[model samples]
Target: MRASAKIFWILGVFFLIVAIAYGFVTGTYEPHGIETVGFPAILALSGLGFMIAMALTLAYRKNSINPSDDLDAEVSREAGVQGSFSPYSWAPLWASLGAALCFLGVAAGWWIFAFGIMFAIYGVLSWVLEFSIGQHAH
Candidate 1:
């Protein structure tokens, strides 16, 4: 986690620098008819993402209970399963279908758009509750 914090800090600062550079470049450059606001905003948003990630990492590090920040501790002391992994599920397929419908709705009509939104919500809810009431759930 310490290593992750360090990495995040470095990346966040790097992106912030790049975003500032982008702002300066866009500010000084001449756009005949092209839009100049979006690119810099995107870059700035990317920097914000990195910065937010860094902040979250730092908060987690501070509140961490185990694995004391000891220099003498060997690296292998932290080896373990990091997270849970589902072996198989149909949730992804449903979610993907919903996303496809959303794309189609953008080109079709508002009725399709509304249906897509409802389908997408159902897919998300289905994914969240997939293991709650299923026979496969433990």
Candidate 2:
């Protein structure tokens, strides 16, 4: 995690530098179009990366040690069941369908958007409660 954080931080700094350099080269302080906004947008993305790195670093500090941080750690040492995962599910498909409908609504009509929202809600609820009942109850 420490290593990962460092890499992201470096990337963020590199992007920030590029944005500054681009501003100087282009002689533009304000974005008048997409082309002018590219560097700043990249800078924002890099800042997000840096923020993520910081979060990881904080988490690492709390945990103190991880397999990747140990030079002598073997793959087998870290190999184990990490968490429970559903073997099969239809929620993702439903969610995607809803998303597609929502996008379609954007181009077609508001009625489609309403149906999309309802589908999205149903899909999310079913997905979230999948394990609360039926054969997969837990």
How many clashing pairs per prediction, in order? 0, 0
Pairs with backbone N, CA or C atoms under 3 Å apart (clashes), candidate 2? none
Compute each candidate's TM-score over C-alphas.
0.67, 0.77
| Residue 128, candidate 1: C-alpha displacement in angstroms | 1.0
Steric clash pairs (candidate 1): none
In model 2, state the lDDT of residue 49: 83
List ranges where model 1 is wrong by over 4 Å: 32-40, 43-52, 63-81, 107-112, 136-138
lDDT of 2 at 64: 67
RMSD of each: 3.8, 3.0
> What are the lDDT figures for the candidates, one per model?
0.71, 0.83
lDDT tens per residue, model 1, 1-138: 555666767777777777777666766774743237765675666677687677768677678634645667777878899886555777777777878888888898767777777777887887787777675565
Deviating ranges (above 4 Å) for candidate 2: 22-40
Q: Write down the worst ten-residue block by lDDT for model 2.
A: 27-36
Q: Write the per-residue lDDT of candidate 2 for residues 1-138, one digit (tens) a residue.
A: 888988988988888888777767666544553355776787797789889889988999999688998999899878988987676888878888888899999999989988998888888888899899766889
